[model samples]
Target: MTTHTDFRAFRIHNDAAGYRGGIETMNTAALSAGEVLVKVAYSSVNYKDALAGTGKGKILRQYPLNGGVDASGVVVASTDPKFKEGDPVLCTGSGLSETRDGGYGEYIRLPSTWTIPLPTGLSLRESMILGTAGFTAALALLRMQDNRQTPALGPIAVTGASGGVGMLAIDIFSRAGYAVHAISGKADHFDVLRNLGAVECIDRHQLVFSGKPMDSARFGGALDNVGGAMLAGLLPLIEPYGNVAICGNAGGIAFESTVMPFIIRGASLLGIASAGTARDLRDQVWQHLASDWKPAHLDRIATREVTLEQLPEVFGRMLAGDSFGRTVVRVGKV
Candidate 1:
């Protein structure tokens, strides 16, 4: 069957005219090279998507590309035998929206290496609701566990606890038997955080860190979405041999901290670069998410659902710091 057909995409472009993104008619033939062509059903917005959609951040390595990093849909056609017509699949990171056309379109061509079969427990829609945000959170937990960080060490502190990754992390970590201590500047949302399984909620604005490099151990580890001062402050409070997974740089990139946490206390700071994650590890994380690590509050975590026309408004709100939870984008009918 011929896969070439006209479809709409939230494509981004840059040239002499300057940076911009909006809905435009496109052809499946023009999509970036891949073995699997999917009729996209759902995608989700992340901080990176907002940045890429609005040109606020340099998320795209090349121009004239579709702009959603997370996508799930049914296969329309496939050159690879692993996928066939109407089989559900999903992909996150792995170069979508950066080096290639992404999920914001009604149809997307996905590399076989990155396409994942829809896990048994998740539907195509639920898979995108988790998206890249949830993937990063699960990857952090897996790495922390690999580094020998355990629940017996102490409670895990989740910074930026009101945002997508933070909220999902609370649900995932709690389901895996870790006591989650949520730290957020939005004190008004503490009760909501509790409902997502946070046992303790700390107001970050009122958090006072003694400038000292070493402090009393208050947490076994942390999954920090805010970096800069937040990362600097968290290190000193981890238990011995604890692991801190840094997934986001919402606060700032640079930070000043002493080596006491690493040298004296054996604290490990793990970097969570979800994009470009090796295929094996990516598969491992997805498997766990479909089973034991799946969040119990996925429906609640997906707080907003929008069509492609509403992406600009969603991007504005997210970049303005008004984003609460995950925003699922309904791309096209399956």
Candidate 2:
């Protein structure tokens, strides 16, 4: 039996004046009521979590909430027969950082239905390394494949290529036999992108959309993390029957574009919202991520790991666009 009564958490509070967040020592009993109590081993920081923690965007629906969107750990207590003590598991999205207390803490209480057993090929650390970002990339690939994307079709492009999802997508797309074209604003990261399996690294500025409604085809498909003008420019360049998955709005949310790319070339614009994915599809995607879809450069993709106390600074860096790759938080031990 353990005698731990208090643990550290990164919590955010909103007030009449403004919002503030920091690491706080919290009582274990104060965790919100749920069917399962998890001793979080690791949690990865997402762009959404950065917004919630730093108040850059309206991510938290409530005040004084724990602020992490992804966690993996062992179950410490459970009221559901689907889980038991000592089971390794993880939960992503399912209203974390928006509707309830999330996984920025040493302990988390979550509905068992949101929990997933750690798949056979992934360890607790490995799962959090992939977290929501890698999962989103894999989900996008699955959707693209479902729409008939194949390795022989042509090169696949990944925008925001230095970030977590982009890095993982590059590796997975290359490993799956697709030629990956990585596009990013960070010139310094071009070599890093190539090391992660991108066959071509193009600067984001290299893409100058011709004013024409539809330009010549370039890529077979794309995983687009930066939205707005970049996305608008990309649409005109996709080959016929190509699909582009839109997952992030780090750039401006709105863009000006003609419908010629969609109507004339049969290109698809896929919207990927990872937070509300159905449980069955989530299970399927995670299983694939653990098995064949797992990237060969997971360790390379996980660039940094910080403790609970260091999360606030990390969030600041993320919001400033100064951070890259994936940063996992060490919340507790296995």
Candidate 3:
């Protein structure tokens, strides 16, 4: 094995100079401690990655770490018996770019517990395209279904419809036999959302919710990427026993609501903290993502492919709300 190969990483630092991120030469030996050392093939951009890359949000626990929350690669070395020197694997969340180095580098050392063997039915590139965004969506669905959410109730509403999670949700949920009502601020992109299997496209700007804690049910459930008022508003419109799996907060954090929906309607608000999901649940989510719950429109959803050098521009676009769908990073050979 290469003991100390020279590789490049999109490293972030915060110090006397200030918070910044850029490509830098690094060594495999210098990467954060892990049992598995992988030659990264691909990584994907999530809103969280953008936040970490630009220091726009408090994402990383420590500084001077490589920046990327999702990665797929071929293992080059491992101390763990479960992984070998030539296995394909993928990881999302589990502290990448948070307290440790992440997948923005050509190489990554992953904690064996968090690394998933590339499941049957997904290529490395496809896995990265699904990455963290699709993982969150699938996890939400799993939680929702476990709590009794079903397609028989009504259509599933996917907010932030053009974004990575939302677009994938439309595809996943619709494929799972539920009608999907997509809501997005970007009205012009409604056609694409529809093509991804959204039965109805509701413009976010035009959709209004009654302030009442309980209203006439419109959706069976929802996979909401927008929190704040969007969350508060949707609560009242959910069917009885419907689950709202919230995975993002792009629309501000705080929200005002009442217990009427919970008490009278039995509505559920499932917080999808995907970053630190447990091993068993993570395994379950990945298994589904690689099989039945996989998004059908992965190619359409992966809107851009870029190298490490182009991350800054991508981050800027994501932060400015100009980015839609997933942006895949070709870290090395795919």
Using lDDT as the measure, the top candidate is 1
Residue-wise lDDT of candidate 2 within 1-334, one digit each (tens)? 2423688889888987679988888876777667888899999998888888888889888878889999999988888999989999999998887888899988988988889999999999899989999889988988888888888768999999998889989987887789999999998999989998999999887767786778888999899999988888888999988999999887889978888988998899999988989899899889988888888888888999999888878989988889989999889887
Sort the candidates on TM-score, descending order. 1, 3, 2
Q: Tell me the whole-model lDDT of each prediction, alpha carbons only.
A: 0.96, 0.88, 0.92
Q: Evaluated with TM-score, which candidate comes out highest?
A: 1
Candidates 2 and 3 compared by lDDT, better number:
3
Report the lDDT of model 3 for residue 181: 98
Worst 10 residues of 2 by lDDT: 1-10
What is the Å distance of residue 89 in model 3 from its true position? 0.2
Model 3 local distance difference test score: 0.92
Error of 1 at 61 (Å): 1.3
User: In candidate 3, what are the lDDT values of residues 1-334, reduced to their tens digit?
Assistant: 7758999999999999999999999889899999999999999999989999999999998978999999999999999999998899999999999999999999999999999999999999999889988888889999999999999989999999999999988988887888999999999998999899998999899998878878899999999898999999999999999999999888889999999989999999999999999999999988898888888889999999999999999999999989989999999983
Residue 279 of model 2, lDDT score: 90
Write model 1 residue lDDT over 127-239, tens digit each, in one string.
98899999999999999999998999999999999999999999999999999999999999999999999999999999999979999999999999999999999999999
Q: Where is model 3 more than 4 Å wrong at Cα? A: none
Candidate 2, position 63, lDDT: 78
TM-score for every candidate vs. truth? 0.99, 0.96, 0.98
On the 0 to 100 scale, the lDDT of residue 257 in model 3 is 94
lDDT of 2: 0.88
Between candidates 2 and 3, the TM-score winner: 3
